[model samples]
Target: MEFDHVLSVRCSVRRYTEEPVSEEDIQKIVKAGEEVPVGHFDFKNYAIAAITDKKVLRLLAEENQALSGRGDPIYGAPLLLLIMNTPEAREDSIKLNAGIMAENMHLKAVDLGLGSICIYSFIRTLNREEGYGKYFQALHLPEGLKPAMAVAVGHTPMVQRERRFVARIPTFRIDGKE
Candidate 1:
């Protein structure tokens, strides 16, 4: 699918089916984000964790559920991808890079006939409360990699599309020339 079409329709989907994302689709989704132009696409720029484990999801969801009061299992998502950056990066560069990658991944997933959502909550707290900070290092990421954002992917109850505007903003003549 073309990039424009994907962007036009892609939005945060709240609900998903019981199905799981195929390995091929997961690769494609991550590949699109990896293609995003980041300053350090090198070894330590960002780490993408595509989690298929419910136990891990539940652990993270504990954070969100406490904050939002909704424990829908992250919208029943099968794949939870978290993007991380290290403290060595530019201030907030970790989150900045993850956001760019998140957008790219959202559009790509839409093009692949799937849906994705960007989620952020309780991760930092979890890192502090728990010892999950080591999770990034366990992935072999350079020490100090901080998780910035997460995206949930799966088949949704509805395929979102760009809404057709029913009305347009009225144009006004500002200058006498008009």
Candidate 2:
């Protein structure tokens, strides 16, 4: 798909079908995440976990539900691509790099005709709940790494359609004359 079309149709897909995203597409999405630029050339400080296990997803969703009081925080997506950061990763770098990675993967999912939603509450819950070490450990991340951000991906029953552009964010142009 063209980049403009992908951007036009890209959206937060909260609902997903039972169908699992194929391994091929999953790898493609992960590749997209891996290819994004990281600040300070500290790529080694970040990692992505492609989670598909039903039990693990359920446990994460349960934690999200408990934290946010939502019925299903993940919307039943079959896969979650979680971005993790090590303790040595700077706060600014973590925020920017993780967001870039998630957006890349999310856009790639849209290009592949899959549904995806950038997830943060789950990560927040995982990081906040020190007692929930078991849930964090379930991810099997390398030592010292913690969940920073995530994007849930899977097949969706909804159809994607091009959307007209809208000015959602305020913008201002500055010139020397100003």
Candidate 3:
């Protein structure tokens, strides 16, 4: 698919079907993320945990509901890609790098005809010093890597494409010359 078409059709999918995304597509998505540009020279600045186990997804959804009253925080997607980085890294750098990785995965998902939505509730729920933080132990991310964000992926029954709007155009006149 063309890059513009991919961006035009990409949307946040909140519901998914029972079908699971293929491992090949999953690897491609992860590969896209891995290929994202790094902020600090080393491209290994982030880690990705691809959770496909129903038990783990259910646990995360239940815990997220209990914490934020948002039921099905992961939208029942069959796969959850948790992006992480060490807490010692600069906040801006970590967030920027994670966003780049996630956007890459998101675009890849779109290209593969899979549904995906970037989720934050999981990270928020797991960041606590008490309560749901226990679930973080199960992730066992390398030493200091902290959960930054999550991307839920699976097959969707319907594909929605965003409508293009041309009501406005860019005005690059900074010198007041109209």
lDDT of each: 0.74, 0.88, 0.81
Give per-residue CA lDDT, model 1, range 87-158, as digits (tens).
666664666777888888887889999978887654555465444533333445455667777788999889
Off by over 4 Å in 3: 129-132, 166-178
Candidate 1 wrong stretches, greater than 4 Å: 40-43, 124-128, 132-143, 165-178
Q: Measured by TM-score, how close is model 2 to the native structure?
A: 0.93
In model 1, the Cα lDDT at residue 175 comes to 86
**TM-score of structure candidate 1:** 0.78
- Candidate 3 overall lDDT versus native: 0.81
Between candidates 1 and 3, name the one with more favorable TM-score: 3
lDDT tens readout by residue for model 3, 1-178: 8888888889899989989889899999999888888876655557898889887788787777777677888788999998888666667688788888898999999999899998776687667745336556666556777788779999999866766956587676478765
* Candidate 2: segments with Cα more than 4 A from true spot: 131-133
Q: Provide the clashing-pair count of each candidate structure.
A: 0, 0, 0
